[model samples]
Target: MNVHIEVRRVNEAGEERTRTASIRDVARAADVSYQTVSRVLNDHPSIRPATKQRVLDAMEELRYRPNQAARALVTSRSSTLGVILGSRGEYGPTSSLAAFEDSAREHGYWVNSAYLRDTQPETIRAAVEHLRRQSVEGIVVHAPQVRVFDILAELDVDIPYLGLNTAERGIVELAEDQMRGGKMATEHLIELGHVEIVHVAGPQDWIEAESRMRGYLHALSDADLPTRAPILGDWTADFGYRAALELSHRLDFTAVFAANDAMAVGLMHGFRDVGIDVPRRVSIVGFDDIPLAAHSWPPLTTVHQQFAGLGRRAVTELLRLINADDAPPLLASVEPSLVVRASTARAFGHQ
Candidate 1:
């Protein structure tokens, strides 16, 4: 199926001929039809793995490069996706975003991102409009703040959209089960026989923070344990350290569950400075299981979220919506697991 065309050039009374590789050349190399090559380029899910690999190998052998402009004109598809971010610097969101981009590229798509400076309705609408202007086929919203969803609901977004961190059920969204993670962390502490456990939670407005706090309370309530009001934090080590100082004077709680690893590590440092040995006099658990968690002084006992899995699933679902293909089953809410480490132990004196 390879198409051959000759180009003639003359230099110093000498004639030369050459040819450039085309999609048909790739098809010939793979022993596939040109239409099969087109399907491979579009990452059609119906294509078998062996066929896809063969196409990819053929494209590489032929040095075939897809001309995005030409493909867009022929198919009327932009082959691009849009992502809107309300929280940019956090560990969990950033980790998920990296995985999402990697999955998109593997599926033969490019990503365009817009970072939100504020959660204002107008700002959210403007970001969506900007992405639409570039003809993105789908959009992924990574803003976990509660108000951001409210603002998004007010906008007249026409394209397919997926939410990475929203709590709304029955929506086209993929997210780690934050509430389950929180419950797992708290239940770990409870299993260690720590009844008076304090929770240092993230900002009140963040959907993740609220969901986690709800989990913590749910665990304590289910166990018939008295629940103390949670300490709201700004999801920072500095805030965790400050909270530790304030909690040090209150001898009421023997354990603390932090919303994320950064705060947990900082809280550990603060407790050490105050002479409260973790797992000895006080136990600590955190969420997200950031890379540093396992190396902290006592090694943090935390909940591990499937950030990468959720990211990949988000792309698959969004693409399904874009293609209007509902034949494939979608993954459910990602589950979280508890990683027990040195930071937690049986109740004091029971050890």
Candidate 2:
């Protein structure tokens, strides 16, 4: 008997041409029944083990390949989730996405990623719409900008969603305690007998930056030290460099707490250019104990945020949201810890 294979072809007008093939053609080749072949192809679990093997063998003999799109049409599940991120080059966002992808794969889901340079409301709306079009079951918004939350609040999508690293109001959120991180860094400096401490802060618009700034003030107030206005930065090495240059000219403070390790590294270089000795003339502390922090001159004393763990937890929460598994939406806040290193020392007089 001739075994014919069905194929789809596009006509000159771009319409599909469908053709049919017979199950008898497949079953005869492997000496199995058409019923057994149907059961094996449809993944019916009731078939006996020996019979199932014969049906599979028949399919192999006929070189049968199942149509995934047809299967999806019946199930109504695309088995995909969407992740929207801000700034792919940043350490935290990039690491979170990688972790989420791995976790999604483990749960038998595919992740569609979209990275944005800025988190404007319109841009976020567009991104969310794009993901919805792809039939994603849920969404993980990784943009930390406060405006993204506003955009999310206005969205009409029926799918469940979660935000990582953004502030919490009513929605489910997963973030590090930035205020605690700031307080930890500042209090450490104060404990070292550095009363005149300055903060080099990240952009004011970002919730993380604002929280850290508040923590710094809280620490200073508790210690009875005067809190100076913080110098603003864009969380970049360049911004840190420029801020350091401006601060070095006057040299009013004995200690500095930069919002992140990259800025701290930049400040160190800036101070070196001005012929100032670190931990002697001025001690410095930084947040986010990134890899480069350890290699910096005199090594950086910094705050460690468990970025990878944050990523893992965020994805886990997102998966729960996707499954409609009767789990409560989680609001997780990770605490920051201080990592003491060589960049800080006793006050100039005590040493």
Best by TM-score: 2
- Kindly list the per-residue Cα lDDT of model 1 for residues 48-141, writing each as its tens digit: 9999898888777666788876787778798899999988888788888898899999998899999999988888988998998778999988
What overall lDDT goes with each candidate model?
0.85, 0.78
Kindly report which residue stretches of model 2 are placed more than 4 angstroms away from their true locations once superposed: 1-72, 169-173, 326-334
Cα deviation at 14, candidate 2, in Å, is 17
Q: List TM-score per model, in order.
A: 0.80, 0.81
- Location of the lowest summed lDDT over 10 successive residues in candidate 2: 167-176
lDDT of 2 by residue, 195-253 (tens): 89999998877767877888899999999999898998888887777787888889878
Question: What CA RMSD would candidate 2 show?
Answer: 4.7
Error of 1 at 187 (Å): 0.8
Clashing pairs in 1: none
Query: lDDT, candidate 1, residue 221?
Result: 95
Q: After superposition, how far is residue 315 of candidate 1 from its true place, in Å?
A: 0.9
Local lDDT at 102 for model 1 = 99
